[model samples]
Target: MGLSDSEILMPASGADAVRAFGDGRDVTVFAGGTILMPMIAYRRYPQRARTLMLGRAGLNQISADGNVAVGAMTTLAAIAGSGVEPLAAAARDVADPEIRAQATLGGNLCAPPSRQGPRGDLQAALLAARAEVRCAVAGRERIEPIDEFLAGLDAEPRLVLGVELERPRRAAYSSQRRPHAHSYAVMAVACAELADGVRVAAAGVAKRAVRLRSVERALADGAAAEQASAGALDGLEPQDDALASSWYRREVLPVLVRRAITQLGGG
Candidate 1:
């Protein structure tokens, strides 16, 4: 839906934007409005855009501790162009070229429907990399788990400050889409730097994006990527979409997981 109405609240910085969400007005935080504008244009939202955009400060800064700090409003183009290896590669694969140029990483993470499913691109990528989406609520607070927060999107009016993709160590994201980033049939991310060795997670196949912790453990123990059996699709419920069949998704997941892990330098 388009904005629910109100005034424009563009804070001086990202931190300032976090504070505004506390005001309790009907404020829907905006970054690039890539998702917001398109929905509105197509009449998905009934009201006009609201005031109060939480600028770069809330989720825009890239921290030096190795994690990429993206402001809630940081456009997808920014993250895609950040030159931050893993994240950059993922961005390069986002839908079509035009969408990537205008969409914000914040918008992609915050809007799940637009992202296709919980197991889609950004969520699965961050989940595997152990990323944290810093958010602000009630009384000057900060939250990290974007997954937990996203689960309850239907229930609250919370604001997304920005997502912090923690320290990167050889990582890669892969997905099954129709030749572009329009959406994903199956999306996977494999990383070797989070804890010890590599971990894999798949989105676009089920709810909450399925993490192959089991496969990760196997890899840590030195199993080759090809050794990642169908077990990699464990704990998932693939869905049928206009793009592909559920069966097709189930069949392709293991391969993608292997490719991601292997390419990231994992066995």
Candidate 2:
């Protein structure tokens, strides 16, 4: 189906956007259109009742005062230079400059797993940072941790407003990817030293990014980076895809985790 067949709503403000996205039923939210445009061109996108365009929704600001706040519509290009550590690095590593300029943070966070491989490269960094997601759901605004948000993504329909988080004392990111920046990573890891302790997360090991709880426990118990990273595969099953086999992802994940943790001064 073509976009011309769908009812499109372009809201000028966040409030209007929320109202237009009521319950998200049969609605496809169009952000930067980095991913959706291709689907549309190839006729792979399903026909939805409505297309809610967020380009002018007044949701593209970044705040870095006492705490950090990023609007859902902020582009990866803007975030690549935001000095947000692993997030900026991950954003810079997304696609080429043109794709990054057109991809929005909200789209990245809500990206589903693709047949080729996992696609949300920024997810690991945001997971490690322990960001909070602000979304409009069920006719109300809700704030939840990133982990919780991801866990419930398939169960509910919502409009992502933005994300908020505190600055980390130290952060590091590591990944194994094809030479082409556009290709998704085989495995990626991100770590951050927060006031409470350290958090670690990885992507490409599953359908979505996941926290390395076993590794975090080992770190809290004073295990060396190498030793702590040995637990990277606990409670997780890697999948085979075009990029690499499950075994290869399993083998390399620990290495990436160790490298990120060591880089974060946890060695």
Candidate 3:
């Protein structure tokens, strides 16, 4: 399948994008297009689908005060250079300079197929940082926690406007991948400070990137970092593929968790 007659609509503003999505027939929102281009070429997505592109949509801005706000079209490269700690660290590991320059946070969040496998790396890092997604559909705006938003990706009609997060006091992200910047990690862990205590999230170890609440509980109870990490993979079913076997992922998950926790000043 190829994009022979695929309709491409370039919206001039965010409001226009929302309007275009509302008329949806199999709409795929194109931001940076790094993720979508491959899906189109591989016939993973319908070849004749509608594509709502975020061009000149005023969604590429990044601003910060006490809280940080990143527009949906903001490039991964910009985020990597934004001095945002763990998020920046994770973005830096996404790919080489070129892909990063063309990848958007919104695309990454929504690109992953809604099934079992390694999803987006930023999802876990954002989860640990307690980020919120701001979105809209047909003039109706919605604001929700990042985790909840991710869980309902298929059902949500809202297009992501931006993400919001408070600046973290301490944060870190780690992943098991080849030294090559473009390689997909078998597992990734992120740790950060929260108002209540420390929070931890991991990617590539389950159907989707998720928080390790069991590990967070262990840390809150003052357990040793090694002990907390050792027990963290209790319920996760890490997948196996060409990059790594399932057992290898399970074995390395705890180590990544420990290192991330240590980096966050928790252990």
> Number of the top candidate by lDDT?
2
TM-scores for all candidates? 0.83, 0.97, 0.93
- Report the Cα RMSD per candidate: 3.2, 1.1, 2.0
Model 1, 99-166: lDDT tens digits are 76666676677665443444235666666766776666664656767667667665765667666765
How much does candidate 2 score in TM-score?
0.97
Distance from true location, Cα of 71 in model 1, Å: 2.3
Task: Show where candidate 1 strays beyond 4 Å.
Answer: 1-5, 23-25, 46-51, 55-59, 96-98, 114-120, 180-186
Give the C-alpha miss distance for residue 76 in model 3, angstroms. 0.5
**How do the residues 138-174 of candidate 3 rate in per-residue lDDT, one tens digit apiece?**
6677889998998887675568999999888889898
Candidate 2 lDDT at 78 equals 94
| lDDT at 52, model 3 | 83
Stretches off by above 4 angstroms in model 3 are 23-25, 113-117
* Candidate 2, 1-267: lDDT as tens digits: 566889999999999999999999889999999889888888877579899999999899999887889999999999999998778988988879999999999999998887688988899999999999999986699999999999999899889999999988889999998998789878899998889999999999988999999999999999999999999999999999999999999889999999998998887
- Scored by TM-score, the top model is 2
Ranking by lDDT: 2, 3, 1
Alpha-carbon lDDT, every model: 0.64, 0.91, 0.82
